[model samples]
Target: MNYILYAVPFFFALIALELLLDRWRGVSTYRFSDTINSLSAGVLSTTVGLLTKAVGLLTYTLAWQQLALVELSAGSLWVWLLAFVLYDFCYYWNHRLGHERNVLWAAHSVHHQSEDYNLSTALRQTSTGFIFGWIFYLPMAVLGVPPVVFLTVAALNLLYQFWVHTRHIPKLGWFEWLFITPSNHRVHHAQNAVYMDRNYGGVFIVWDRLFGTFQEELDAEPVIFGVTTPLASWNPLWANAQFYVALWRDALRAESWWDKLRIWFMRTGWRPADVAAKYPQSKPDLRQFVKFDVPLSLAQKLYAGVQFSLYVLGGTLLLGMGDKLSPAQMLLGVGWMAVGLYALGVWLENRAHAKRLEVARVLLNLPLTWLAVQLSLLSAGPLLWALLLGYSLVSLAALLWTPRTAVGVPA
Candidate 1:
């Protein structure tokens, strides 16, 4: 039923509501650049998923057809209930291992990179989780959960998680005992020593309770969001690659061959002794930790907001029409999205070169738009081309009007 598609507007609407609720309560839980970066990662993830989701679907279908334990009817309510429970059971392990293992954490860490906890944080996701996440669900396919049932329940499980990413919601008494309430899930996102690697369940909190990974949120200690080793930049592409690059560098520097071979699979933060000694990484002191920010003029902030809104609209269009696209067309869409997002990141970081890069991006849109028409992804009409040209020119005009000193250098 493509439930995720149907929920898109609701997701943004709730985020808007959360913003209003925050203002009413007189607390700020969102930063403009951080929210933009979080949503950019989500946009990149969804756009990339259009290409990679087939891998899991194909693998699940193959396993279900070749090695079914029994023929399970998708129509049965009992079967649906069982699949729902079992999917969360599998998700518990998938999510637990994602935090515990180095390579897996690399793919899963994007969701935790946001320093602020709000509804937009719920939408932040990884672009690369499809690589190994499919294997965790093989048991369902083996139990003969039909692909349709598995897919529907999986979407439901994900949709159920969206609302729990906020700081606006306080703990519910008995509800916290059963499902994953916002309070419990907030602890899961914490980088504090007391809360790290706990509460790995999606919809249900019982998995954590049974598995002994659950920790109650303490009033004495506030949860500090984000990874211990902070993601200080706003780049979506770099956010996905940072951990991998860190591991790769450590692997190359390791003194022993075994260390190099096994580093990727070792416990989440493990590093070779020699590599650790040579490259001492700074872990922030949580008591005095500061959130990453870059100053922007009001015009610059408005310009960024306008550009991001266009990307969001463009992304929604892509998601709706993605099935009709050829691989080449999809790749083209990806390229367009990636470039726009990366440029936005540069602008957010207030890099000295942002102006040059943005100018190039707008100019490049001309050729990219022509290619989109040739690929039949866009209609070949003068008005459409003129609108594209007009957007670029308008953006350029806005850029020129914006103060160059607003964000001097990437902090």
Candidate 2:
């Protein structure tokens, strides 16, 4: 798709623009690793999509069909414009329902995990959105929107969204009324009680204005952006699963089986009494929802980032292999990747909850790393052995192997 070609440059341009605009607005609310984390998640998501497309879950032809349908409409320019409008109308519902449904919320929440409002937040999207998200756009499919045109418009709509993630821009008076300007979208990102679940739109703010979902940005208080239940972690995988794990836990605890299914289908926050009795936490005030600095020392973050970067590259390379490898081979690599994602998510959470799980994440890496090398089917030369040993030992003792976290700080 050469998405990296345009998407990368487009992203960097927005980032530069956001920084300049932030300085102009006197809003300084960005961190290096957090921005990197958001970008990393986006990269991971892109890789996963490539893998799925490779493995055949996502066929390219549906998009082709959607594009071909667009060509059949009468009166070229006017019909294309109408098709674009209709497509956005469908997107508005999809975006709204994403917030209303628990399952969809789980997937969508990844983008909102960051408390900081900046351009990088826009890059963060769920890898899992391919599941059922296509349904919202099916109307275009049924209406015979050319698969190619549909794909192009969808990209344009998404690219439009990237500009709205920043808090740098003030409300454009007339523009605010007509389009999904930065101001209205900032309110959408806000966790404030009054602002939550409002301003659901894709390209045009008119949809939100027309539907009464629009809330103007307030001057009285600043907007605090994030989810109702805080992720409070750096791991991208956990960010995607936080709500989902809660739903699963609730489902298993529910006495009735119906409640189990309903946990996913019901209102985003609805839960059985037993599950509801101890709410996750009350929504945080935007005032108190300040940015968090990672407690680790700079050197540790570098070390961690480096190690994490290797895993990311490994995953990306495996995904890229889908074109070269047979389906069975691709599935084997992807299945192991699924295991790796689960392990990393649990490992990060366990660091906060149970030390053992964190340790297990490292320990498990020994065998996993070996498997990665073995699957490469390369000879166990001294160099390869040394590399494997280094990754395994360091990854296993990542907490201890690093200079700072190595010694006693606290248990």
Candidate 1 lowest-lDDT run of ten = 402-411
Instruction: List candidate 1 stretches off by more than 4 Å.
Output: none
Error in Å for residue 276 of model 1: 0.8
Report the lDDT tens digits of candidate 2 across residue range 1-411. Answer: 434435766786878887887688787867755765676677667656755543322343454454444445544676567668878998899889999998988888888888788888888888787776777877776566665566667777888888888766678889888889888999888888889999888889899888889899999857877777877766677676778898899998887788888889887988887766754546665555556444555655565456555656665565445456655555555555555554443333324432344456556655655665556633465676687677767665665654433322122
What TM-score goes with each of the models? 0.98, 0.77
RMSD of 2: 5.0
**lDDT of candidate model 2 versus the reference:** 0.69
* Best-fitting candidate, scored by lDDT: 1
| Candidate 1 Cα lDDT to native | 0.93
